[model samples]
Target chain A: MQKDFLELIRRASCELPADVIRVIKQGRNAEANGSPSRSALDDVIENCDLASRTSRPICQDTGTNIWYVYHPRSVSQMALTRDILAATRKATRLAYLRPNAVDSITGKNSGDNTGPGAPVIHFHEWSRKSLVADLLLKGGGSENVSAQYSLPNGAIGAGRDLEGIRRCVVDAVFNAQGKGCGPGIIGVGVGGDRATSMIEAKEQLFRLVNDKNPDPVLAKLEKTLHAQCNELGIGPMGFGGLTTVMGVKIGARHRLPASFFVSIAYLCWAARRASVSIVGGVATYSQISQQALKYKLPAVAARKGR
Target chain B: MIRIELPVSEKDVRKLKVGDEISLHGTIVTARDAAHKLMVEEWPKFVEPLLKNGAIYHCGPVMKKTGKSWKAVAAGPTTSIREEPYEAAVMDHYKVRFIIGKGGMGPKTLKACKDVGAVYLHAIGGAAPLLADTVVRTKAVHLLDELGVPEAFWEFEVDGFKGIVTMDSHGKSLHSALLRKSKKKRDAIIGI
Candidate 1:
């Protein structure tokens, strides 16, 4: 039962997601002048089409294997984390993924995307029947832009509101402008301590790129924030383009003020990951891709800079 | 718009303003993070010769080996900002005059672009498959074992490879201008 799920992730790691695939295709409107945009879109799509055929990553940055586990039953006795790691090992091998984790100081490659910080698996306990895992293979190009603000020490603004949060998201993307390869989306973590905030920021990516915030206030804030981010003109690949924020996924954690840690994790569209679920010991998957996970991007393509 | 080969000099690059587009015909080498680091470390031995006649493209293509032949299905320009730190040194070491990739180069690369008669060409990001069509031939390769295809040196014989002049030898950058312009419009609408 577990082997099939593990095998699914192995295939997912190398495969581009549908949403990301859409963004990769839509980001190419820059060449609207002629076939450059269309041509580039065709090229990327060809790569995507061949991704499964070639069993190769659509983009080079295969990223870290992150598992967001939502447990169904409060009384569930499954070895939650152990099971995830077991599956991670299998996926890593099948994907032929390059080792992206190792000693930050020694700078040695782990050779298989595994290490102490290799696959960051997070679990949330809930009551239900099946276990659901939102897998994300976060690439380094986007991950390198992660920013942390230890509220009491680093934050410059007082009375944290939508503006303050917006600024943080802006500043993060701005500082990352042309570097983290914007116009990428910034995952904003509002309401939590430093540790909790970091995790929340990452989980926010699971939200659909185009879905609107259910909360009216939050939705307005998100729209405003996204528009400002695009204004940064850190175009396609940060060279300057219309679509910057595919969508901003926000996550919150309840914590005291003193425990507050505001963190922002930026995600480039190349973010890749996928997963399947084990139901009644039978397996089913959403078949969502880590790449081509086009958030709310109006344009559904990302073109290569000619 | 007619695509013509333009040989721009450093002095000419200094005069470029924002939003001017141009197409170039010449030799360019593909390299990303790892290869850039390697070239910086090795300096003369690895970079000098080809750089004299070429440009450096920041790209990593999705490749595959089928029946003893290597083919690129999607070869797109990666983020160029990651190479900012090493670009100036590499450009100076190799005396390069052009850079082609997605995302514009950084201040250091920008400065080098101005000083060395170079231009940072912006390729449409995420169009790897389309760009692959432009690469008529992969004439040779280097350092494949160490870094693999996406990060290896793929000397291509290309015809009419297209890109926008986001950052030119004339010190004009479309990215910065767009950011500044859009930021104001957004601020007004948001009233922030």
Candidate 2:
């Protein structure tokens, strides 16, 4: 189980799924030939190719480890955490991940990429017998541009409704310019307190890029925001071209009457993510954005695999 | 388009204009948050020789040890704005001619570049593998034990390393110009 999980990290670091590659190709084709934006996208495509081929990290930062795990009630969180930390340490040694976690005040790296609150794991109990774990490697550059807004932002004149939400989202993309490494993906959380809102925002990124929001209203907003953001001409790496955002995924939760928060988590084009399913000591690996049907389950003996 | 070689000459840096595409050759040094802070405070004596009239890239590269040497697996430009506070002082101290990074710098770094005849080059962020291909060799690394992999100062011999002159020695800044233009457009769209 540990070895399979480590392989998932290695794969996520190196290979961007087919869906992300598809959108990037679409953005590249939309650009005019010989334009700087086109050239920038060309480099991005080349980078993806090389990273995947060489089984190297797609970006240097390699980012914070975020794991979303849905497991049967029988599974132990303590065991999972232990295995995750071990896998992370092994990954760091293999150069599949950078040594990212640091002491906030002392400016010390944990070296093994394990420390207090590193490899953040969100575990959910499920009725099913199997366990599913999804990993998102959110790099630092795009993470830096993520923003949260309080309602009635006087600067942008954003009121506390969907219309205001649209304005705020557009403004966030605009302000990001070439910084969050656009053409980027935006995950938005419409409600909740500050921390929950940000978590929900990041959680939305787990959705496939091409997937529609399950809720119709949010779906419409997502579609509208995607179009409007691309209109900003931020293009790839903010070189100014046709595409700024590759996709926008919005998720919502109930908020307190006093608070209305909109949090945005911007993901770069690398968009590295993968998932694994463990059932009865057999493990099957898959990528999130790639069409699930396309992957044939490669089962490994969970105990002996490690 | 321009071709630049490091340690870049003041005359060559002066010739670079805002918005010019450039391909760099020779050697460049990589530094991010930790290395920058250390460089400013300690002003490492060894770095002065390497940085003088040369470029400092804002990068934390993904490196692998291959046999006796290290190799840059992925080396992309990090966001440069974070180093804005120390950049001007470092530029002055080292006589560094080019600052290579992404996301541009602020008024302080721009002023420093103009004053010191340096330029801020914008490489495509997230194109680490593409950039790594240009690195012919990992020349050396400093502060590795203290700073760790991403924060360490890595020197590399590069060929055909491409970037854009976003902030030039002449005081023009393409990043600033783009920000202004984009803000106007954004305001119009949002009715701000």
Candidate 3:
């Protein structure tokens, strides 16, 4: 179990999922020829390929370790948590993960990445007699730009409606500029309290880039926001080009009438997350097809000045 | 692309513009949040010799120890804006000619770039392994015991460490200009 979990962590840290690479390539094609944004995207793609090939981390920050595990009722959650923690420690030592957990009050880093709340794990019991694990290595640079807004946000003139949510989303992306590391993917949560809304926003990031939102209203909003964001011209790395956001995902939950909260989770182009399932002692991964992993240089030398 | 050998001068960086692509060869130092704060507070003289007319990378690297020496496995730029508070002071005090980071810095740092005769080089933010491949040698480390691995100052001998000059010595900033244009677009879309 520890070994399997370690591989999961390694994959999450080192590789960009196929869907992410596809959208990034699409963004690259959409940008003007010989633009700096296109060059930046080329460097990004090359970096992902190198990281995946060498089994090295995609980004040095390696981010906060977030795990979502689903298993049968027979399995003990405690034992599962213990194994996950153990795997996290070993991964850090092997340099598959970085020591990122720091003490808030004392300003000390827990060198092995296992302090009080390091490697946050969410456990659930499902009826199926199988186990599934997902890991997200959310880098700190993008995470710092994540925002939460309480509606009737007079500052932005946002009210408690879908329009208000759209306003908040725009404001978030605009504020992020290139800081969130554009071309970014945004996950938005609507209609929940503060905390759960943020969680829902982050959970939306686990969905594939090509997946459509099942909610009709959200689907339309996602489409509009995706287009609206790109029009901002933040481009790749905020160099002011066509593509600022590659994708926008919206998720909503029930909320009280008195409070309406919207949360935006910004993910960089890296978008490092992976999942695996185990049934009958056999494992299957959310695979990255080989063709999607191929690398080529941009038409103009990306490293050369425009 | 412009090739700059280290131990640079104000004149070398002054030639860079907001959109110039450049590469650095020779020794560069890594410092992040804690190290920046410490450097500003203590004004450590030891690192001054290394940083004088040289580059300081805003990076928290992933390193592996091989036998007795260290190897940078994945060293990429962290967000530069986080160090906005101390960056201007660090540059002016240490004579740092290049600030290598991503996401760009704020007004004070931009002013300091002009006043201090420095430039802000925006690295490819998440291109960790490719950037790490440019690190020819991990020369030494400092503050390992106090600041831990990621926050420690790492001295590296590099070849072809590439970036775009987003903020240059002529009082121009690509990031600020982008933000102003982007804000106008956002206002139009949001209608507020």
TM-score of each: 0.75, 0.94, 0.95
| Deviation of model 3 at A8, angstroms | 0.5
DockQ of 1: 0.24
The per-model DockQ list reads 0.24, 0.73, 0.83
Worst ten in a row by lDDT for model 2 chain A: A297-306
Please state the error at residue B192 of candidate 3 in Å: 1.6
Writing each residue's lDDT as its tens digit, candidate 3 over A95-196 gives 999889999998899999998988888888889988988888788888999999998999888999999999999999999999888788899988788889
- Runs in model 1 deviating more than 4 A are A1-7, A10-56, A70-99, A123-129, A150-158, A181-183, A231-235, A239-241, A271-273, A287-306, B1-28, B60-74, B129-162, B182-192
Model 3 over residues B1-192: C-alpha lDDT tens digits?
A: 999999898997899999999989999999999999999889998998999999999999999999989999999999999899999999999999999999999999999999999999999989999999999999999999899899999999999999999999999999999988988998899997
- Among the numbered candidates, top DockQ falls to 3
Clash pairs of candidate 2?
Answer: A178-A238, A182-A237
TM-score of chain A of each: 0.80, 0.93, 0.92
**Superposition error at B30 for model 2 (Å):** 1.1
lDDT of 2 by residue, A99-215 (tens): 889988888898888888898888988899988888999998899999999997998889899989999899989878888888899999989999999998898887667766656
Q: Provide the overall lDDT of each model, using Cα atoms, as 2-decimal numbers.
A: 0.63, 0.86, 0.88
Ranking by TM-score, best first?
3, 2, 1
State in Å the error of residue A287, model 3.
5.1
Writing each residue's lDDT as its tens digit, candidate 1 over A1-306 gives 357657656566556667666665666654454433344344456766766666655555556777767667652435766566566665445543444565566555555556786677766666667666768766666777789765543334523566666666766776666555454666777777777787778877766565556567777878877777776665555544566667777766787856655688887665555666566777676644222233332233233100
lDDT-sorted candidate list, best first: 3, 2, 1
